[model samples]
Every structure is written in structure tokens, then in C-alpha cells.
Target: MGLVAINLLGGVLASLAFAFVELRPSLPFLFLTTLLVGLILGGWAATSSPLAKLYGGALTTFLILFGTGLSPLPASTPESFSTRIGFVLFALAYTLCMTALLWRAGRAAENSRMA
Candidate 1:
């Protein structure tokens, strides 16, 4: 519960920072931010109970996907084919990293509980 609260607070801070910063056309910064956010949330979810982890993981994944999909391009400007492909690849890589972090954290939490 404490972990979740901290994660949520961090997320709020990140969102405010992003909102104030001028990130237009800054693909690299956006990508890095998303990666960081996903990893933090994933790690937090891993520390939760099994059922909470499942929901947290799913919600985190969805938010990551949705945010990345919408952040880079304006609605008025239709994304080019290559740009779409790039977003897909970036999302895939982000997902994999988040999964790995969650897995490691979960294993550590479980082992500690057993001990």
C-alpha cells in the first residue's frame, strides 16, 4: 500500500512536470519519460498482492500504450506509416522492459516473504 501510494505520487509529479515542459517534437524525451514511468509502476505493482498486481500491471500497460500512442503526433496531422511503425516498436520495447522489471521485483518479494 505504501509502495502504491509512492508510485502514484511520483506519477502525479511526473505528469505535472511533463505538462509544464515544452515536449513538442521531442520524441526522445517522451520515450525516456514513458520508459521511466512504466518501470516504476511495474516495480510497484510487483510488490502488491497477486490480485492487485494483476490489475495494476494491466492498468499500467494500458496507460503506457495509450500515452505513447497519443503523445508524439497531433490529431490533425495524420501519422505517417513509418512513424506508426516506430511507435509500435518503441511500445514493444517498453513493454518488455517493464515486464522484466516486474518479474524481478515479484521474485524478490516472493523470496523475501518465504524467508
Candidate 2:
């Protein structure tokens, strides 16, 4: 639980920084941020279940990040609705993929150590 909370905090903070601070989110920026955050959050196998911590932390962080991205864009019309939803989906997918890769690598390392 503590590990999950800590990972969640770090991931969410990284996501928020991109959301609020970055005026224009480029591909490299998104990849680097997510990769770094995921590496830091996942590479530490403090608990027995690194997979649970990684997935839980990542899913929750992005869900919250999704809300942050969706909040300001009040999608009233069809075009805006699609745009907002698409943006949210695309960003979430891209970030999650990168994060998941790093997290999985960490989990594998933890497993190897246990064996």
C-alpha cells in the first residue's frame, strides 16, 4: 500500500507537470517524461508484488491525469467532443504504453531476483 501510494504520487506529479507546465507537448517530451517517471516509479521493487504496485499506480495516475486533461475542455458540440475524447485517449494510450514497458522491465528484474 505504501509503495503503491508513493508510485502513484510520483506518476501523477509527472503527468500533472506535463499537463499544466508544458505549453506544447511534443512526442519526445511525452516519451521522456513517461519513461523517466515509469522507470523511477517501477524500477524500485520495494514490495513483494511489484506488478500490482506498478499497474495500480499507473492506472490510477492516468485516470486522474485524464480528468485533468478533460476538465478544461468543455465539449458541448460534436466536433469538440470527439476532439477532447480523442486527445484524452491518444495521450493516455501513448503514456501508458511507455510506462507499461518500463514497469514491465522492472517487474521482470524483480522476478529474476526472487528466483
Candidate 3:
């Protein structure tokens, strides 16, 4: 929990710094940064953990992106109901992909620690 909080706060700070540097970053750039940074932060948190708590890393990252306005910002809202649902599904897929990557890194870290 402490690790999650730390990463969350750090992510917020990083987002703030990014905003300061680029007052109007392109949507694609923002998304690229968000995903790349999120993965890095997630992996770092996993490595720091004494245990491979993948859920914690994923939850922390999802919250961090949400809190920092990194998610749902790169794209505008669609008018159709189905489109909205599609967007939501896309977000869910993004989270799942992130979790899968982080889980692998966390599992490796856990294995290394046991050796």
C-alpha cells in the first residue's frame, strides 16, 4: 500500500512536470508518455515489492492515470452509446495489457528474490 501511494504521488508529479514542459502536447504524445511512463512506474513498483502483487501495481497505475488526467484525455468523447462503450472497453483493454506486462515483471522479481 505504501508503495502504491508513493508511485501514485510520483506519477502525479511526473504528469505535472510534463504539463509544465509542454503546455499543449499532442494527443498521441501524451498517450505514448502515459503508457511508457505507466509501464516503467509499474515495473519499478513491482521490483520493489517483497512479493509480486500484480494487482497492487495495476491498481496503482490505473488510479495514477485517472488522477493525473492521463487517461481519457488523449481522445474525445464519442456521441453514440456504442462508441462510448467501445471507448470504455478500450480503456479496460489498456489496463489489462499493462497489468499483464507488470505481472510478468513482478513474477520475475519474485523469483529472483527467492533464489
TM-score of every candidate relative to the true structure:
0.35, 0.35, 0.35
Per-residue alpha-carbon lDDT of candidate 3 for residues 1-115, written as tens digits (9 for 90 to 100): 3444444455444545355436666767767766766666566667756644543554464454444443345554222322433444566667768888999999999999999
Cα distance off (Å), candidate 2, residue 65: 2.4
* RMSD list, candidates in order: 13.3, 13.9, 13.0
lDDT of 3 at 36: 68
Worst 10-residue stretch by lDDT in candidate 3? Answer: 76-85
Top-lDDT candidate index: 2
Candidate 2 deviant stretches above 4 angstroms: 1-11, 19-24, 45-60, 63-115
lDDT score, residue 5, model 2? 49
> Residue-wise lDDT of candidate 1 within 1-115, one digit each (tens)?
4344434444444444355334463778657665666676677677756555654644454464435445646542224322543554565567668878999999999999999
Candidate 1 segments whose C-alpha is farther than 4 A from its true place = 1-21, 48-115
Clashes of each: 0, 0, 0
Query: So what's the TM-score on candidate 2?
Result: 0.35
- Model 2 C-alpha lDDT per residue in residues 1-115, reported as the tens digit of each score: 4544444454455456555435555667656666665565455434567465655466456545543443445553334434544555566666678788989999999999999
